[model samples]
Target chain A: MTGHPHDHGHAHAPAAAEDGPPSEYARLGRAVREILVEKGILSAADVRRAIEAMDARGPHLGARMVARAWHDLAYKARLLADGTAAAAELGIEMGPTILKVVENTAAVHNLIVCTLCSCYPRMVLGIPPDWYKSRPYRSRAVHEPRSVLAEFGTVIPDDVEVRVHDSTADLRYLVLPRRPAGTEGWSEAALASLVTRDSMIGVSLARSAHEPVETA
Target chain B: MSDTPLRRHHDMGGLPAGRVERADHVLAAWEKEVDALLVLLSRQGIIRVDELRRGIEALPPDAYDRLGYYERWIHSITAALVEKGVLTQAEVADRVATIAAREEAER
Candidate 1:
């Protein structure tokens, strides 16, 4: 599956810089907009409205999928077996343009990285977070997933295993980490509480009621 | 130009950012890609070199550090363009409408 080929090239460097207190990118964008108007490529009103829309969409439906699976065993099983279908079952539809989701399980601890560029499953997981598309995470994750995980403060047991899923083509992955112990009667919402974005990407495990960790 | 996107061919390692060594490797690659883009866009007249240079200079010392990754750049650009009217609201609405239509049609 492919995503909307939004500009993923070098043409965006100056504008792609990080936002500070005042957000320099915003200022640069204004400059770029002025140039575009002078060149007759776009109108000011049009650009302002479009940015508003992008923000409204927020993260993709995949975050909900992860939350659901954390609470239900059968759904988690189905998600693991057929991610695209399972997601639809929850009203999360995938388009021809949308990338398919792959669930990484315990036998194979699935990790996601976009090595070449940031091709991701945005429809489900929202936008691929910044770190997922970086060159370092992509390059080293494939070469040394364990070492990479350790950097994130995630230490996989020797027996748990690791499997890195490159986010390319139509196949983007979400890790269905093994549910932690000590929360037998936890509600789905409660379980969802433990499913951090990092764990969903498979670098860490979902927190159990007993061993809670910081999730941002 | 008309091939499977090159991003699919390269291998991405892990998530939540990797170790400094891995992080450095990835950031360097993205920075290189960004530089290449600056040059190419300038050649295409999509951007001016002086303007780009000024913009680059104006960047916060921790601009990249605050965001700390390349994909953030991609996200912000996409967001900023959409905001600045470089991308059209109607275009996004129409694409979304088209996707919704196709789904209804499929069912």
Candidate 2:
């Protein structure tokens, strides 16, 4: 079950990034990159800087935003109203991407997927997980969402309707998981620790008050 | 990639597929380079993200399956540059051969 069992039937890991050699396409990438630098189309330093900047981002940024929303209702209203502007308030660059934050309520559980390539909230969550770009997730998430959630060990009760958001290149979606119970009066940093990347993706819920928060 | 009324292959929403393999992996070095290249390209207005997706979707079904996420991306990036007349096909081909030979000699 590692791969999609669709028109193509095989079981492969989503991304064993370093398992193989530098493929022909890999060499092509290097060649293209070198060519670009040689012609001054883009400098090598620019590429390095871009990578560093992209890698510097992660779910922690999204966690901070979510934690703030939980602590302040006004921020929550702002986040839902214009995500790009709200993110700017915290200095998270949305650039040209229009951000949409969906909240999970008692009656509804939201899941986000990019059926087209792997369009994700990279500004907030960094790079998406490899499986998020895999065929299975792109294919099944919009249809059998409940089953997909179940596979991720997230079970939404039948009473709670599952809403699957199909993201596009113009807009990206992030799920603000419901604040877990027993977290009353928690500090913002402590509350942020409970927001995992998967919870933001809506594959699972935020860590509960009793769940061990990773201090690292 | 187009404003086509028809559905594109990448548009796989609601389709039947296998179970999701809920896992994550650190990106490979080359993948990061590819990612950076695309980002710079977009920032430089050389290629838009939508154009990249179009190039990716235009890939033959076999190559689509054979390559990983960034693998497909490199091809698209290369194609976009060539399309923009920024780089020629022969130059890229020759450069790839040279790089491959150098790597082989180093090994």
**Tens digits of lDDT, candidate 2, B37-87:** 899889889999888999999998888878888889999988988999999
Estimated TM-score for each candidate: 0.54, 0.91
Q: Local distance difference test, per candidate?
A: 0.53, 0.85
Model 1 clash count equals 19
What fnat does each of the candidate structures reach? 0.23, 0.83
lDDT of 1 by residue, A1-216 (tens): 111112322122222223322233332333334444445665434443333333333233555677677677788778878887887897765544434445555556777776655555554655455566555676787778888788888887788667776665657666665667776776766666676667777776676677664543
DockQ value of candidate 2: 0.49
Q: C-alpha displacement of B43 in model 2, angstroms?
A: 1.0
Candidate 1 iRMSD in angstroms: 13.9
Q: In model 2, where do residues sit more than 4 Å from their true spots?
A: A1-20, B1-7
